[model samples]
Target chain A: AQSVTQPDIHITVSEGASLELRCNYSYGATPYLFWYVQSPGQGLQLLLKYFSGDTLVQGIKGFEAEFKRSQSSFNLRKPSVHWSDAAEYFCAVGGGGFGNEKLTFGTGTRLTIIP
Target chain B: EAGVAQSPRYKIIEKRQSVAFWCNPISGHATLYWYQQILGQGPKLLIQFQNNGVVDDSQLPKDRFSAERLKGVDSTLKIQPAKLEDSAVYLCASSRAGGQADTQYFGPGTRLTVL
Candidate 1:
């Protein structure tokens, strides 16, 4: 079984400040990790994903995540965040094919942007 | 490309009532997923489908929950005798099938509130 853990339950950051959300995963083989964001009433949007090569991966809306195999972590980072960035963020892991893959998601971290 | 689509954006019902959610995946996507997101928790996978066939439903409470994908393109999830604990956002997601690079795209989700 695969699982994801997000240490922070809630995070608050001032507008224009840098942001980082921690994520750790437990999987036997090489894992595929992803970051997703959800607005108040909208579905989740993919922030980024890491499958193979290049530990650092970039995503939409000025977000990036680095996959650290040694640490078993894939943390999301942004140089600056906008008020719109305030939302619930989730970390997920899967270890199979597209049609056959099963995902295990973290409990999620609620992000608040202080204006 | 159009994103995943879900119906009845919101639903309010009393305990023991029944409710159903519908989802339309992307045009060529061969995999579909159903998830539940509580108020402060991350989305949990309830079921996964591969072209009209179920791949996983281990986490689903079969006693009250049922889902089906008739043609592999669209899916429906039903909850019979809903409970207050069933109040959450039901989300539908889709991805291209075959290999490990299945990046899921989520729908806006249907918010179900049990009174």
Candidate 2:
């Protein structure tokens, strides 16, 4: 079964500071990875996705994630975090088949930005 | 274009009561999904539909939970005899099924509380 793991439960960073959120996955084959963000009382928004080609994939909101197959990791990063970036972040894996289109998500990482 | 639409942003009911949530996917989306998210956890796939057909429902509890996407446009999720542990956020998502890459758009979730 495909699964994802997020080590950080919560993280705090000052405005304009660099940020990184860790994610790891377990799957037999190459996994399709994704990162999503959710604000309070809102639906999750896609941040980035990794399919095959590039190891590093850029996303909206100045965010990016690197898919490291060796370590089974797909960590999200931002050069600087804005106050508006405070939200919950999730990592997910897909790519089994049509019946397996459902993503396997990791426990989310709650991000808090400090002024 | 409007994103996925979900009704009843919040719901509170006593244990053993029945409740239903609705979702309208983005126009032309062939695939729809329902997920359950517990507090501080990632969303779990409850069911998946592709053009009104059940693509996958392995995780859904058939005894008390049921869902359908009639005519391949809108969908509904129902839970009978809800348990206290079922108090969580129910999320809906949509995507273009049969694509090489599975990209899903999410809807604002329905927060459920069982007292």
Candidate 3:
């Protein structure tokens, strides 16, 4: 079974401040990680994904995540968060294929930005 | 390209009532997925379809929940005699089904509220 853990349930940050959302996972094999964002009344939008390349990968909307194999973590980070960036973020883990392509998602972290 | 599309952005129903939601995946996407997301929890995979065939339905409640992608393009999920626990956001997502790690595009999701 695969699972993702997001330690932060809710986080508040001021505009222009750096932000980091922690995500840890438990998987037997090399995990494929992803970050997704969901606004209040919208569906999730893909932020980035890590398969089997560089440890760090850049994503849309000025977001990036580093896959730390040893720590079983793929935390999303941004140099600064804009007001529009505030949304619920989720981290997910899955296998490449081999009849195990379904994804297991985290509880998600709700981000709030203040002026 | 247009993203995944789901109908009935919001629905309110009484307990034990029946409800159904529809989804249309991105063009050329062969893999479609349905997920259930509670208010404060992450989205849980309920079913997965690979071009009109069922790939996985382990988490879906077979007794009350049923879904079908008859044409492998548009899909529908139905809940008969719905329960209070079933009140949540139903998300539809699709991927290219490349036999490898692929990003799943999501729909706006249908919010179901059972009274």
Best by DockQ: 3
Docking class of 3: medium
Model 2 chain A weakest 10-residue run by lDDT: A94-103
By TM-score: ranked, best first: 2, 3, 1
Q: How high is the lDDT of residue B7 in model 1?
A: 98
Model 3 agreement with the true structure over B1-115: per-residue lDDT tens digits: 9999999999999999999999999999999999999999999999999999998999999999999999889999999989999999999999997354777899999999999
Output the number of the TM-score-best candidate: 2
lDDT of 2: 0.93
TM-score of chain A of each: 0.96, 0.97, 0.97
Off by over 4 Å in 1: none
The lDDT for every candidate, in the order shown, is: 0.92, 0.93, 0.94
In candidate 2, what are the lDDT values of residues B1-115, reduced to their tens digit? 9999999999999999999999999999999999999998899999989899998899999999999988999999999989999999999999977453868999999999999
Model 2 ranges off by over 4 Å: B98-100
Each candidate's root-mean-square deviation in Å?
1.4, 0.9, 1.1
Q: What is the lDDT of residue A44 in candidate 2?
A: 93
How many angstroms is residue B3 displaced in model 3 relative to the true structure, after the best TM-score fit?
A: 1.4
